[model samples]
Target: MAFESLASRLQSAFDKLRGRGKIDEQAVNEAMREVRLALLEADVNFKVVKDFVARVKERAIGQEVLKSLTPGQMVIKVVNEELTELMGGNVAKIAVAAKPPTVVMMVGLQGAGKTTTTGKLAKYLQKQNRKPLLVAGDIYRPAAIKQLQVLGEQVKAPVFTLGDQVSPVEIARQAIEHAKENHLDYVLIDTAGRLHIDEALMDELKQVREVAKPDEILLVVDAMTGQDAVNVAESFNQQLELTGVILTKLDGDTRGGAALSVKAVTGQPIKFAGMGEKLDSLEPFHPDRMASRILGMGDVLSLIEKAQEAVDTEKAKEMEKQMRQGEFTFDMFLDSMQQMRKLGPLEDILGMMPGMNKMKDLKVDEKQLGRVEAIVTSMTLKERANPDLLNASRRKRIAAGSGTSVQEVNRFIKQFEEMKKMMKQFSGMADKMQKKSKKKGFGLPFMGKSAGNLPLKERGPGFPFNFKPPFK
Candidate 1:
């Protein structure tokens, strides 16, 4: 959503070159001109935009078009790769200290989402099974300490506070000792933030750094700051020796200039991105995925990787085999749903899909899936395994049992039948694809079907509209 305007502008620029078989120098120049304006409008740093456009032009001009591909797509691909390179090509992991109780000091300006990001980082580390202790090192604001405490409670991480009476350096030192005593693996010290750069703040941060001996000093910055965000990062890095940065408020209506500027200017990988206000909304920064999302091309690679992490491979293989044999049933579908549940919430799962984020107008009811789950739970084991055994009396009983109308039950059954049919067709296609992949060693990018053009009616009973390509 934050990248919507930029996505539209870039898409339009590329659309102009869509059908061109060969990208001539003139065409590339024209496209680059549009791209330049788009980036500027998106609040990108002037120098960064210039350099980015130059690299894209260098790769796009006179490049031979791929078979069955338009020049626009090729240019988009080049821009994506350049964007990825500019943002750090690979994912960066937080470094653990050689010693125990790895210290992480957070530095940022006021309203930069520093306190929230501190909590998100704690949640992230805790998810990795690390015992983290959050220290309220911000002595200036009472509300800041309370916010950290609330966040600490939310994350179920311990909060260390010395109240507003103590100096931040003393609090940080004591917090580190507490971390050592408790055998906490990580200590996150949330320090004070100023609205702007000031001498006193920098001096205070330096003092806290000396006391904490932080393994990593992460500068948390708001993505909405545009180019000024880069200046903040630079100033922080210059004084605090920041190891990395966390770009927060990325889910806000930001111009995306901060994200582009921070990494390129500071030469520090963006360690994480704050995608939403939820405590669990933070995600490890992925350059390629972000690039794809910006260009409106979708981030298929990250989506597949997320699926790999979420899905049970052995069960997936079994399901694949069953579908190939046209044996996919309601039971199999339920099992798959349960497996998906194991991967985290459905919303998070869908968010990682390539074009799913683009479906702003398509109101897909997530509650319907809950209803299906409820209906499935209401079914008996035999009914779940063999839907053919459900006669009229059984259907009526199931309808009553699920607290739904008989018509709803009938609709569910009809939808299940159609899903089974679709699964069989999909399986056949998948089998052919598997054979082709075995021969070629590179699988198709997608299912080889355009989900973008799917008819709304065929998208399942409760589905409101055709599925977008995935994270559009």
Candidate 2:
């Protein structure tokens, strides 16, 4: 939901263009005007917006695009490409040192979530099989070093501290030696931040940079601060010659001005983004995927990556077999819900699917999933495995245990049975299709050999139950 308002406004502008049979330059100009206002309202830097709209207009008015069969879509394509280019065209990877112990200096103003992002970066490195040592270099702020130490402990990375007695420059220099001695692959120096940009802070950061000779100097900025975040990045880049930026609180930045403006202003790519407060919420910034999301095209690649990371493959295969056999049950339903929860919030997950944004009335209440899980959990093991055992008395007991009315329990059961029947129909159709494919001496493209070979299970739940649709 970072660019919720901006995306909605932009999509609205595009919608009007799409409705036209053929667009003239005047119509294109009109749409661009709307786009300009939308971008400005989103808090994008005014000059950036002017240049962006000008570029889009120049291309959109070209004969090649205006004469295209789908001129409207052509215009949108141009906008998407330009937007992606503005955001850095591609993912910016973290720098690696030629030698071991890559030193990264994290700098920013106070209250920008710099310390927390340092810990998140350490966790990201650990996932890449690198041993990262976190240095507690923020000695000025109250408990800044302690905060970094807590984060290091949470990520299981060793924190090197000089007890706030030594100068940050010396601490950073010694921390590198410590990392070298321990054979750590990366050394993250959490430098102190001030309430605002000041000469004293810049001088101290400069000294630390001189000693550490950091491979990367990343400026962390809060996305919710709008253009102030961009200004901070510009100031830091001027003094530190920052290699990249880390945008935190991006998930909560509805207007997303900083994310849209920072790279353009600072001439640095956003290397990472903090999507949530969790230590694992940090992700490599991908501009192309972000543009796709802003245009309501959905980020299928990121969604697939998240699924591959969060969902167990073997378990998914086993669940697939159960679906093919029409053997899904309450236990399977509970398990599937738990797996889905690991992928993040339901609304965010749904937003990643193509065309989901167009479903204006679609609502995904995460609490509903939790409630369903509670109902399933209240059931006895035998009841969970065998739906037929959920008689009236048992339904009442489950309803009571789950803090719901018996009528709600009955409704859930009815929906579950309907879902099972639908799965059975799908299973039979799949079998017939497979047989036909074998007879034709060719495999179905969508149903690969791995999926087609999954044998049926005698007893299990049907495919995970589809929640009641919230579509109006």
Candidate 3:
């Protein structure tokens, strides 16, 4: 939802062009005008917005024929491409040293989430099967070292600390030696930062950098700070010659000025984005996927990646088999809910879906999923496996246990049955389609989700028990 307002505004601008069968230069200019205003309103840098609009206008006016696409669509395509380019065109990866112990210096103003971002980066490296050593070099802030230590323990990584007495320069120099001795592949130095940039802060960072000889110096900036974030990045880059940026609080930044302007202003790519507070929420920045999301085109690859990470593959397959055979039960439904929960918030999931532009704004019933889970959990194992055994009294008991009225339990039971029947019908349809096309297996792509009649983007996974996400 970072670019929610900007996306809506841009989409509205393009709607005019989309309505026209053929677009003229005047129409393209009009759309660009709206786009410029939208970007400016989003707090995007005035110069960046000016440059972006000029590029889009030049291309739209000189539009070439793209087969199977209307003139309006072509203009949109141009804008998407330009937007991608503006945000660094490709994903910039974290630098890896040729030898072990790739040194990374995390630097930014205080309160920019620099220390937390360092811990997240360590977790990310660990996920890649690399041993990362976290260096607690921020001795200035009270409890900064302890905070890093706690994060290290949470991630199961080792933390190198020298207490507050030693200089950060010495800490960095010694941390590298520790990593080398321990055979750790990456060393992340969480350097100290001031509330604002000062000569003293830069001098300390410079000294630390000289000692560490870091492969990457990442500038962590809070995206919600808008223009101030870009200005901070500019200041850091001028001194440290930062290799990349980590945009934190991006999930809360509706304006998205920092994300759009940081790289453009500082000549550094945004390597990672802090999507949430969770340790695993730091995502490698993907410019193309972001542009697609901003254009109301869902990021299917990211969605699939989330599914792959959250859902158990074997369990998903077994669940699909059961659903196809009409053996769907309360247990399976519970498992499906658990799997979906692992994928994170319904709003975020819906946003990643390709055609869910309208659905993203739907009030996410967070408690609805929890309510279903509670009801199912309150059921006996036998009752879960065989929901048919639930008579009126049993339903009443379940309602009481789950703290719901009997009517709610009855409604859930009825909806679960409907979902099972729907899954069976979908299985039959998928089989016929599979045979007709013979394209690789088209089984349920996710747990408890079927290939429904709705377009892939609009189709919410089938959780047909009270959670009415948009579906055909």
For TM-score, the strongest prediction is 2
- For candidate 3, what is the lDDT? 0.85
Ordered from best to worst TM-score, the candidate numbers read 2, 3, 1
Model 2 lDDT tens row, 1-472: 6687888889999999886668999999999999999889888999889999999999999998889998999999999999999899999999999999899999999999999999999999998999999999999999998999899889999999999889999999989999999899999999999998999999999999989999999999999999899999999999999999999998888787888899899899999999998898899999998888888999899888888889988988797777777677887777887888888876777778776766666777666667778888999999989899998999999999998889888988898888777677767766765687676654422345444334443122222445564334
Residue ranges of candidate 3 with Cα displaced over 4 Å: 63-69, 423-467, 470-472
Question: Candidate 3: minimum summed lDDT over ten consecutive residues — where?
Answer: 441-450
The sequence of per-residue lDDT tens digits that candidate 3 reaches over residues 382-464 is: 99988789999999999999998899889888888777676666666545555643464343433323445435743324554
Candidate closer to the true structure by TM-score (higher is better), 1 or 2: 2
- Stretches of candidate 2 exceeding 4 Å from the true structure: 440-465, 469-472
Candidate 1 structure lDDT: 0.78
RMSD of 2: 3.5
Clashing pairs in 2: 327-460, 327-461, 327-462, 328-461, 328-462, 329-461, 329-462
Better of 2 and 3 by TM-score: 2
Candidate with the larger lDDT of 1 and 3: 3
**Number of backbone collisions per candidate, in order?**
10, 7, 0
Instruction: Show where candidate 1 strays beyond 4 Å.
Output: 58-74, 126-129, 143-156, 181-183, 194-200, 224-228, 251-255, 277-280, 312-335, 338-409, 420-472
